[model samples]
Target: MTKSGHDILKDRLRRAMGIDLQTVGHNSLRNAVARRMRVLGIKETRQYYELTERRAAELDELIDEVAVNETWFFRDDTPFTVLQRYSRNWLKRGRGSCLRILSVPCASGEEPYSIAIALLEAGVNGPLFKIDAIDISYRALRLARRGIYGRNSFRGRNNFFQRKYFQKTKAGYVIAKHIKHSVNFIRANILAANLPILNSRYDIIFCRNLLIYLDKDNQKVVVSILDKLLVDEGLIFTGHAEPGAFADSVFIPAPYPKAFALTRRSAVVCKPDRVSYNRQILPPSLPVQPLWFTELDTARELADTGQHEEAMECCEQYIRRHGPDKEAYFLMGMILTDMDEPRLAIRMLKKVVYLDPNLVKAIEMLALLYKGLGDDNNYRVFKQRAGRVAARNQPAGKGSE
Candidate 1:
């Protein structure tokens, strides 16, 4: 008996591509086969499936079409936040060293470009830093190399980066020369048993928001491969929503404050002079985080409209993105305090202090909020801490306001 068209498609797609049409759902599979058949000039689905089975290269091309490719520049904030922090510190530590990064499933190349831009922003330059980007689609790779997109791509673009990083042309907006030069985009399938293009280790691997589409087992396999590619003492950045995907290893969350990035825990984690990661039970008094003002302005507007709920939610969203700034928590605390939610205000202000120990205004407001809630002990403690920190960080003639 001759097999049906659907049967052939299921078998060829599964065998040739490791893509189980059964897992892809029958309806979606049917649509994809139909699309490919029309493009391939196969009069019938059976003929198309037969072609794919007989032709390995055609099968590879078809697989690229079926794979997911949806992405945008700076799609999530946390990973970029992690990138920014690591670049500053790493450049300080490993000056003149080659810092390499990989962007898996780098759909259409915008992501890799963004990472390159981030590296530039963090002051990595002069041939010391490099980026290795990959994607499954030759089609997407072509577009990425062009480095030109509609000016609308810049609309509502919360980053002022492009104003400095792009040049206007009849060909559209070309990426700045520096960003374009730092990155290398290769086209390859990440799901394959082996990756030929990426044989070397990298300082960072940004495989964000891509694994959620895969089956559980495939997700694990891909993650394991990515983990292997990451350098010891390197960093990994992913989506906040997909944290459960990587609930393993010494992959503790790095404090991006507002964004999400994870640092690889080496066998021996080093200690910086001012900050000690080990033997440190001290309260977090680090600065709130470097603020990316372009994104911050939107969150600020959300607060001005009395959309406290949305304002706070936006604040939380921004925090998960890696661009944590001290002002975010302070804004949130002010909203709660105004609403007479003193308890929440005190808690939020505590976060501000951890982020910026010398955030005197936060301490003052927090003390008042605590006193309103009958928490005199906290009010006194915060007040004293604020006084001492102000005196310490303050200029000799300057006093705490």
Candidate 2:
């Protein structure tokens, strides 16, 4: 494709999905375009560009090729913890007859399914909550509607939910019928003028990781749409890199460690440091933590909120005060990975794995870091190790229906 044609197609993608070509990478856009052209048997770039202009369906096809749908169940784990607590409160207080939640760009089905599982575990019955899962990729939506997931979708150390809510099948793990029924999946771009959910208001919105791919102007536009869709005191859960997108908007960070939640400025009834909602929901029997533990918690929260420098300082201090701690090293590895220092992150993750050989998350991180650095030997070694550890730690019984 010529440079001019590529530029025109990039602009069209920006207008259609609020995507920043630079963030998605120029090479990725070029590759997606080339793949679509090949699939359509078109030889000329100009003809393909003209076809995109003439047919909306062709543009949609291009979008399916370009969209990034990498996600897993309980990706971060903290946001769902926050949601469980918040839903328990909503149910206790009788805030409404039904709690409404929205998950946009809910890649595949893991996120919405995870949300349902969290609520169910929190004792919120199926009839008391409604979830709307939306995505723009037709291919991803089809997979989501199938409600079947491979091992890649179930990451992390916990497979308790998998054992409880999914049936092991030859194809994959088939999601429970009730959990699949709980989420209503729809295919529509969130940036469209006629957004499907404009007429509705939600109590909770999970818009994680979508804003980072957009330009500054589109970021602001998305924040406005989120504000319009949220109720007066509703919460917005965003990705760790996305809190800055709402910094100048009507949203303020909610007081919960690692939750990455925000609420309207007008809803700030309590001080920022105090977690009144958490206190209300936390059981009285819960134990208190040591001062050093709270400091590490603060470091995790800082990292989640994009204060990488401060977070690194906190980690350094923790290491200085306490001798080489595996948890601190693991946290440092994660922060370094986010800062694009794969080598440094690899060192930290290696220290973590050395201290606790069976720590599957750290092992997985080492595999990914090695893969990123193009060290296929080390990557394969750690990848195989992680798989072995995961298999040994699997829940007692095979998954049941």
The candidate that wins on lDDT is: 2
TM-score to true structure, per model? 0.67, 0.69
Query: Where is model 1 more than 4 Å wrong at Cα?
Result: 1-26, 151-156, 248-250, 265-401
Alpha carbon lDDT of each predicted model: 0.67, 0.84
Per-residue lDDT for 160-251 in model 2, tens only?
79989999999999999999999999999899999988999998999998899999999999999999999887889999999999987999
Worst 10 residues of 1 by lDDT: 272-281
Off by over 4 Å in 2: 268-401
What is the lDDT, from 0 to 100, of the residue 127 in candidate 1?
80
**For model 2, what is the error of residue 95's alpha carbon versus the real structure, in angstroms, after optimal superposition?**
3.1
